[model samples]
Target: MTFSWRRRRSGRGGDGKSEVFKGINQDMELTIPTHFRCPISLDLMKDPVTLSTGITYDRESIEKWIDAGNITCPVTNQVLRNFDQIPNHSIRKMIQDWCVENKSCGVERIPTPRIPITPYEVTDIRSRIVAAARVGDARKCQELVGKIKDLAKESERNRRCIVGNGIGSALADSFESFARFSVDAHVNLLKEILAAFTWTFPLDEEGISKLKSAVSLRCMVWFLKSENDLSSRQNAICVLKELISADQACVDGLMGIQDIEETLFHTVKVPICPKATKASLVIIYNMIKSSKEKSGEIALKFIRMGLIHLILEILVDGDKSVCEKALGVMDSICSLEEGRENAYENALTVPLLVKKILRVSDTATEFSISSLCKLCLGENESALVEAMQLGAFQKLLVVLQIGSGERTKEKVTELLKLMNLCRDKVDCVDASMGFKYIKRSN
Candidate 1:
């Protein structure tokens, strides 16, 4: 049903009728004006802002759309030349006036939205955080961190403005500077700093270097083991992933901390959250991808810690995204000769790696194929035989038919040739052989 209100105007040139609205209100039977509604939400625009494409939307809706990585105008689909949000003051005023006039119909006026924080304000906040950290003022530092976290949550604009002003580097610098303070007395301060740092992710090179410092690494490991709050631990792991990726030297720093590997292993074995588990996998991958000598040492450490078994189990149980990350860690470890030998010895390795081919994402497929190739190319004939019996040949053929990158295609072709060369041995192998468990050599 259409609801409208028409008021007569008494004037010389008046047409004697006023404009009408097309709106719907099932309970109150009230009609709203079409022009007063936001295109994206189909509700009255509370804080209308127009885009460069001449389309107007509610501030919250449009900001969320843009923040989600969209660059086009929601209505027109035109590419946004800039990210500027121009407030539609006249439309907001009209909406307020309409709400007041329709007060009897239960329409309430929306309060004016506060202006977004400016870059200069974020710079000042950064200075305060730095100053607090410099003086070893734990109380002051925690308060400033809390305030920054609250400001970040206020709006996307605030976050962008703060990030643009380099709050990430400031937080990392402050966090590193906290090494002089006592850990027991400043747990809350460190935790709050980590919590706030998560809001400023994708840190720059300078920030990553500071966060990966020896002191920072030790403190983060402590948080992972001691913090009762799951979010705090997850944030610590997330930050660790960045710090580890900063450089190969980062792995050397982690090796000195004996419990860090164990902590990460337990996290993967008994996950508190999918995100934490995936981050742990990436961290392991980076450690395994370290410089030649350190890479072997780190890979051996994790393998002895039973990370390989956990990775195989995750391949069977995890969702596609988690499986992809697990495969990445597997691929990196298998790059080492010792790693390949360990994988070749495990019964679950062949079956699980074969199971992942073409089943998950393309990246997962690449990792699975690369790791299998490494293991099969080894001196172990049984590894190749296991691959053939476990349907690796068929899955690999399917991968080829579907098209792959040049490098993947090369590995696929090479593995297929090797398998075909041993077709006689493969046929004699028992088809019912569920798994071939080759015990690790002493």
Candidate 2:
């Protein structure tokens, strides 16, 4: 609806006709002048402010327009003189008066808007948090942390202010500093620190490195086991993922932490958060992708902990994203003979792996075939018979006819040939067929 109004002149240019907005109540009506509404939002101005062009707009709408890199005025195409929003108290007060006058017509008055906190204020909070940490006063530090959280939630402008000012480094420094703190204080402090990282924008390379160096591995292990709050636990895992992922040396260090391994296994089975679960899984996958010796050790551990069972369960029940990760983790672990032994022993392994074929993404397809090929080609004859009895022959025929990537198709063909030779020995196949996709390039 277009609402228009003209200024009344001292002469007879004034018209008795007034624009009216009828409320749901038949007797109640309100009339908002066009000048009072923002051109961008088409809503009554809550905190009207004048731009460099002397054009009035709601402070938030114009501020966002400027923040988004627009230099021209919304109404007039003139370039902005400067990106300043001077508060127009006169117009704001007029809007408030109008809302008050129309109270019976269901038009509610807007509440006072809080100004965004400045970088100076965030820097001051960081100092207070540091001073509190120096004095070992957890209470004061916690209060300051709560204040930071409140300021961060106030606005996107305040959030950028927090990041631009060094809150990430402050939190990382604080986390490392409080390692020797009392148990309750340490856990509480860790929770707050992770909260800051989570709610703040993402960390830069320097900030991530600082946080990774500050990570106390022992405390994180205890956190995974002892912290009852799921969010805190998930935060701990996220921190580990960043630290371990940044450098291969960090992943090597984490491999020795038995508690880290144990808790990761626990999380895979009983998830705290979907993200945490995936991070935990990806960490193991990263370990497997690292040095061969270390990858084998982690794979054996995963088998002993029955992580394969949990992975298959997720592949069957979880979303496609989680399924792809699970498949990758499985493929990584299956590089070890012990891993292959455990997988083939499980009755659901081959069938479930086969079920994932042509169902999930192409990455899932490659991993599934790679895992099966590992078990069948390397050693375990018993695993080979298990694959056959579980309908591997039928699945391979379908796979050959439909086909995938050249390398994947090559692996499938090799498996078909290998299993075909063992047919009479295992006696597990009904029939076999050949396909043109398997033909060698001339």
CA-lDDT, candidates in order: 0.79, 0.74
Error of 2 at 147 (Å): 1.2
Candidate 1 TM-score to native: 0.80
- Report the Cα RMSD per candidate: 9.2, 7.8
Pick the TM-score winner. 1
lDDT of 2 by residue, 1-442 (tens): 5474332322333342321232335443345688789889877787788887889998778878988998999999899888767888888788888877877765577666677777778889888887887787777877888888888888777788888888776666566667656556567777787767665545556555555552456566567675467877787787777666655566766766666667888877888888898888888788777745643666676678888888888987887778889999888878877787788777778887877876788888888888888878866776667777777767777877776788788889888777766787665565444444455535
For candidate 2, the 10 contiguous residues with the lowest summed lDDT are: 14-23
* Model 1 ranges with Cα > 4 A deviation: 1-30, 38-43, 49-97, 100-111, 246-249, 291-295, 428-442
Give TM per candidate.
0.80, 0.78
**Clash number for every model?**
0, 0
What C-alpha lDDT, on a 0 to 100 scale, does residue 372 get in candidate 2?
Answer: 85
lDDT score at residue 341, model 1, on the 0-100 scale: 76
